[model samples]
Target chain A: MHIEFEFSGGYGGLFAAKPLGYRVETDELPDEVRDKLLALIRDSGVLELKPAQATGGPGPQRDVFTYSLTIGEGAAAKSFAFDDASAPPAVRPLLSRLRELAVEQRMRP
Target chain B: MTFHKCNCHYIPPHVLGNMAKKGDPAVRQAARTSAQQAKLSREKRGVQAPKVPEMLTGIAMATAPAPVTAAREVYDCQNKWELRVKLARGEGDPEFGDDDVDTVYGYAETVRGYFAELGRNSIDNAGMNLRLNVHVGENYMNAFWDGDEMAFGDGDGQIFTSFAQSLDVMAHEMAHGVTQFTANLDYYSQSGALNEHFSDVFGTAITQYKLNQTVDDADWLIGNEIMGPTLYGEALRSMKAPGTAYDNPLLGKDPQPAHMKDYYNGPNDNRGVHINSGIMNRAFYLAATDQIGTQKAAKIWYHALQNLWPTADFDDAVEIIVESARTLVGDGVVPEGTTQTVRLAFKEVGLPS
Candidate 1:
């Protein structure tokens, strides 16, 4: 299964979005790394995340970034948004990896 | 080869190592724990933790004399969030025709005046110059101490006003600098909350000291003036009533907890540094208003801050504050009942006295 991600807010305003059925073969990543990453995503429970608040607090979130992620597509598609100020602990590693992927995608020719 | 550096910070390793050998078991354990954590923190920060001589029996390391004058610098980000923007004003510079610049410069001087009156050399106790950046980000609504200098935002015009408008916000950020120079409290978990707590404490202290307001007369609301007319809450955080700072349509209700049982356990907000600090903040408010006056309470808290380690937690805070108060009372620096008042205050906050 492939993952789609979008991010905004904060200083950088890094943003991205992907439609459903975006698939990446396991061969794209090393076997060990891919397995570990897949396990992290599976255990993250991202599929059940409800939509988070549009803004964090009454005060402006200077360094807080908002992230929206989708796993799978069509009837199985799940999307959730979280900000840097209040992102759940279990999903942090996944988000970090996705951020790296986003950066790599940006640098490609 | 990776160099293993001495982990102890602020306090020389030789001093703590000597305590580890000669002091009681508890002292030894604390020294060891501090050393270990310091090493880990150094590793994380990737900075060289200087190693001092194991046995400095009677050596006094040569150091430069501290500057006597306070230096202040303010910068304008020009609505950009990037740091190190153009220097708008410097020490003794003429006004830049900018309210935020003048406010930050004047406030820094005010904070410096308080510290000088208290016999503190500067933020680092070495006369480190105060650096401030204002108008950070387009409509950004927050101000923070980035471990070295202070940064402020203009705030979204609709929801919040310029952060520089509030004296307490400036004092609060500068107080973080003071804590950095003294305790260098780690910025995560309970220690992080303590760091925020000490900032808030001195934040209110500077405001009261400047305005010559008594504990009762003071509003005890942080960022009180920076709130826009349309915002829901009166202030960003309230020391008088921790959970009642603000609640409105644009901004959600304040989530700060006033007691230990209500402490947030989530992994967000750096383990709820801003949220749980309300407990200790209230403890100080209670101690200052009902028990001892703000002067004695501030002295006791400052002493306690100096006694705290980087990894100190809530219990450590209670213990140190009470001990500091008792010591001050014994020395006649504070009146009697100070320690009892401190204990009662902590007890009221659901912390062991």
Candidate 2:
């Protein structure tokens, strides 16, 4: 499986304007990292969550990160959007791990 | 870490009544059970509900008497995504000895005191309590105002640091609460930008006041103190010179526009709420430096902020701000020609565009 992640929008546009992005192929990763990512993905149940469930509720949430994630590739790819304020409890671990990978990879435009 | 769970005791009877009437079959049954459980819990605690009309009960709940003085509550999240996981300290409590908690507590005091000087009781001007959460998550890199309270994150230590350490950041988030209670600006498009602009205005003004720095003495930069080693000396935005705060490979160049001609009309950042705010910020900087001073300039802006309504755009802001400056000038709060100075400052930034 392939994964793409982006983190943006926060206080003072520090992380915004130019969002941090990363793309990784599960097969290309070391065995341990690949297993962890796969585990988190399974735990997230991202494929099953509805848009309303994934996104934040109504009302203003200031200075919080907005996240975009995609899993798989081509026709099989699935995408999801959420923010730090309203990410579901089950989906948080996956988002945290993706953020770590993006920062470690130094992925940017 | 202690895991706080919501039980029947926390649900108000009015909410339970509505739920029992409107919820689905399973939800209705659960609501009824919860209501019964709540009554039992109240009796166990020796708390009794007042006998009143149903509508009056809701009114009383909604208008629950506010505290005469606001209190501060700081929670330690223990590097988890959850908030208020552990009570680290409360108002008048001894320092927790944790740097993050201690620093945030002090900053909260400074913010509360500053607002009091402006004749504001608290965020709601009703002595609303301040709830702050620190160490929010593992390598969390942001701080936020979630309408009711504020939360800070210990950054990854590469691109940012503990947001709790910044006084201006705390004041900025708290000002969002003030905006919420006052104008209640919609968080999108132009109105959203005004919301952001007012926060930045208060953030800088309060910081300057706390530091005892004049307009000439201040750097007029936001988020400069939070930058970690990798991005040291690079700020997130510069009110004095918009679009010039930062330029680097990691975060790209700053995208703020100081004038309406270069305004950002993109769909990103909630229609450029943070981006377009630079125009207004520059306008403020100009007015402050033109002898009116930051605090006085802020007073005018605050006056206008209270008068603004939801969906107010840049043009609406210009008219209201100028009117506010005029009113302050007439009252001798600001020096003569203060209104013209404000108008000229807005013209310099291409406001009312």
- Error in Å for residue B217 of model 1: 1.1
lDDT of each: 0.70, 0.84
Estimated TM-score for each candidate: 0.67, 0.85
Return model 1's CA RMSD, one decimal.
Answer: 11.8
Which candidate leads the pack in DockQ? 2
Candidate 1 wrongly placed segments (more than 4 Å) = A1-109, B1-69
Candidate 1: TM-score, chain B only: 0.82
Candidate 2's C-alpha runs over 4 A off are A73-76, A107-109, B1-68
Give the Cα-based TM-score of candidate 1 against the true structure: 0.67
Instruction: Estimate, for each residue in A1-109, the C-alpha lDDT of model 1 and write its tens digit.
Output: 6566755322111120111112344447778867876887877666656555222221212224456676775688766666543456566556656654554454445
List DockQ, one per candidate, in order: 0.05, 0.44
Docking class of 1: incorrect
Best by TM-score: 2
DockQ, prediction 2 = 0.44
Model 2: pairs clashing at backbone N, Cα or C within 3 Å? none
lDDT of 1 by residue, B255-278 (tens): 788989888887555566777788
